[model samples]
Target: MSLNSVLPTRPIQRLSEALANQIAAGEVVERPVSVVKELLENALDSGATEILIAVEEGGEKSIQVTDNGKGIAADQMLLAVSRHATSKITCYQELSAVASLGFRGEALASISSVSRFELISRQDVSANAWRIKSDSGERWSALEPVAGKLGTRVKVDDLFFNTPARKKFLRAPRTEFNHIDELVRRAMLSRMEVAIQLVHNHKTVRQVEAAVTREAQIKRLGRLLGDDFVTQSMHVEFEAQDVKLEGWLALPTFNRSQNDMQYIFVNGRIVRDRLLFHALKQAYADVLYNGRHPAYVLFLSLPFEKVDVNVHPAKYEVRFADSRFVYDFIRRSVRDVVARPITQADAMRESPASVFERPDQHRQGKSVSTSFLAPHKPSPRESQAFFAFQQPVELPLSDVPSINEPLLQAYADGSDTRLASTSNAIPPLGFAKMQLHGVYILAENEQGLVLVDMHAAHERIVYERMKTQWQNQRLIAQPLLVPISLTLDLADMRAWETHQAWLEKLGFELEALGPQQLKVSAVPTLLAKADIAQLIKDVLADWRQHQDSERIESQINARLSTMACHGAVRAHRQLSLAEMNQLLRDMEQTPASSQCNHGRPTWVGLSMKQLDSLFMRGQ
Candidate 1:
């Protein structure tokens, strides 16, 4: 055999500087959007108050970004386009904890390598700006003096021109523009204090001024996310120790089919982290319709050292030192906001007086903010009492009829004049006038007509009450009169054995009967009537599916919801006015009572003007 037969096919060799950069560019610059993201980050890090972007042919022909940021000095202008050179960090310690949006410095080098790049900048009020140009990855022209203001401008033409293979991967102009548009949207949401403008094909498409005020912030949110999102969302804020969360979450009923509208920012850097997304998804579980997603723009702030942002090349992912703690905080905070009960103020847009106040006060003075549970403050014990159904607690309303008493009888005396006299004593849900076809409860508040779905409202009330105690670790467990025996496989047996403590926390007691047998000796007291054997089997199934994440609590919630639905009062069940009013009162105190377990609204409030418009009374 000759020497060639014994040797390798090819010899090892070092890649050239230009070839190495283009290879690195494959990871950093995928398309026009990648270029946009890097340039925008640089502008933001430079303390740019405002930035302008221009694109032609979806950035394939040319792309330009101008920013009112402190420009780069002439001396460092050459180094700015060099790989591994950055002004943001000087040491490994700074690299470990990066605060600026762009720290690695590879963005400029990769971008300039594959395109005809031109950079112009003037620091402060300098007499002239310095310019640099590079047509290929290996060589760059010497810095030359140019006339310019105190800012920076970057231009790239013929992207992927030298690399025909990469150019072939480019999509249609409109499709590429969509990617650039989305990138700008993320930047806009990340820094509300910075003004941004986007122009494509010589037309201004997206532009937003600095959002310095709360109203302006909301306006920008509306402009970017749509007016419907702003109107349908609730303001949310939560802070604990080192973490703070602030954002707007859309109501459960206003969900979308895709997760596209969800935006999460960590320390002003936009990220699409799976952990953060999972926390939010779990928070909205069972509340939003199945296969639907909630719209939100949440900002998370914590110590920079606590989160590692160097995990991904695009910096779109992060590693939290205490991931579980962060997950729980985000989950609980979002859950609380999405589950806030409906108040009278929410039902009435412009009411002058509280309807639930005493009859005299209803006729005079400014309206007090009050919910249907007016005079009674909710107590944890009261919630426990609500589930037991052992005690008939009376609502503290001297002017209102008690549970056993009928509001119809209280308001009626067989004369129109007596009914007119009692109108001033209306409550927030008002006095239930009558049951409409045994399915609807028609009532009247001070502002307008109020309608309630007797069955749906009762279902939500029951589910919320049962969930509240369980969440607070106050779930009452009932020992079975006769323990149900079950046979299980090896996996099921081990699951139950391993998760005994967690099951107990959720108010379940399982015992081993044999190697493949299990005994269900207890269950949550509220779920006592549920099929014990099937419930455990379902729970075990869930335990297997989510064994990795172990969010078994949410799976249990789903089962409880089904039980609550079956146990609630059925539609078309005739009820006295007092029973309907009682449900209304419970609803105000129940979290997430605005929507049923199916994510459908449980009630509707029609203002006087809307009611009048239906009959052409005002028109």
Candidate 2:
């Protein structure tokens, strides 16, 4: 407890340049993926058009990145590997509007300190390439001329070899490689104009050609994201307040079990910002199933001054000067596009035109564009179907027992070829052919075939309708027989006070029992079955964690999802053809109907080519 001893234990001394770099390396060079990301950014910033990445044993043994970028001169080669050396920016003023991806200039220095590193570069105007080498936080060797292309090639060997502690944290080769692959994928997405190639253990893994056109971009996305994602995705382009967003978002039906596929880039820099992710989640809240994540590759561009990218050491996180505005912009953009009904163009993209339309249509003056589904207003009855189902009635047989004959007759009167030719007139879901095992609904549409989960689809439709109605009606408060009292921390109390009115709107009747306590008298009727105390605690936590947002909506939605599940039409219950058609029409009109409240795909489209491949067509 001696103050003098504790204060005098160490003298004020400057750290060695090597030690300083090693410390920086501890932050910047986290793993193979981190190194790859930094190098990729540097290559891109250097005006690289083509980048080739080679990894041996998941970048542990060696990592080589060759890029056709503007290479450095011999005099600059040493500086490039030195700490805090950068050509990206100068002076404090430049930090506010940094446009380069690797502006911190700590990556090369940091990485070289922990690994055996080499840099070879030959400027377009230079006679030959100059090479520099480094090992174990040592100063780089003198630049030596060597034969090389008019670009730069970086080689990292024995990563973390000098730091046994850092090497201990490295994951398995396959696992680390997965991280590297994902980083490369994001880098590729951030710069579509750049061709990127990845080689692991001498085996070519991923190769993307330069994309300059929309078609080429789509092809590249398809190659990376798979044809299903490309087919199921919607193109989005929106601008507001000089901020532009452009990308492809998978439809609500096209989702993943994990959030691995979500990529968001801010001004060409890939990031994992909470604000961006929260906005995306909110946008897909109504459409995506619970616990399911949407897949999207989005790019947002704005003036560099509007965002702060220098807040984090690794530059993976960013702080927007107008975070609220940014969030609203992204949310609105996604919602605006996702809320729109699927049209003929969407169907065409999902399958071949020949499968959905007559070959003569291409020859004729008429076009398929006119055949797409126009926006139709939903009927009040259809919108209120969820409420109707809640009332007493026969489950499936009692409602429309004899409605199928006429509907079946109408479909039976038209031949498959005729139906296919006049696709413009047919509904997007086409006509229901039959139900399979009381679960799946087999239907034919412009796109080869669509299989719908009758129960899941109806569940979503009902859930959406219920939500719409509930929002319009507002929550009705149900009084509790006995009041419940709870204590709150100062932060939670402040949150409760700030969000008092919002809580009241959600049908929570609570009053302050003391400075840090309250008595709950009532709760929302819809959430009456929920654990009231736990729900309140969760709401308070949300309010404290995410100020200026309605977290209760998600909680309420969860409860409503459970209700919809129970109220939905059960499987094995036979449906009349009319009822099935009505459901299909309802689905077309309902927003986010492609997915259930819990995020499961309600329907899947099978293209003709897929079917043909399965049957070995023309083989």
- Taking every candidate in turn, the Cα RMSD to the unseen true structure, in Å, is 8.2, 7.2
What TM-scores do the predictions have?
A: 0.80, 0.84
Per-residue accuracy of model 2 over 220-284 as CA lDDT, tens digit each: 99888777667667678999979999988876645666787899999999899988998898887
Cα displacement (Å) at residue 285, model 2: 3.2
Compose the digit string of candidate 1's lDDT tens values, residues 457-549: 787766666666566664568999999999888988888887788888878888888899988888876667777787677677756753323
Stretches of candidate 1 off by over 4 Å are 1-8, 349-431, 468-500, 507-551, 612-619
- Evaluated against the true structure, the overall lDDT of model 1 is 0.77
Runs with alpha carbons beyond 4 Å of true place in candidate 2: 1-8, 286-291, 346-420, 432-443, 447-453, 548-551, 565-577, 604-619
CA lDDT, every model vs. true structure: 0.77, 0.78
Error of 1 at 182 (Å): 1.4
The lowest-lDDT stretch of 10 consecutive residues in candidate 2 is: 365-374
Which prediction has the highest lDDT against the true structure? Answer: 2
How many backbone clashes are present in model 1?
0
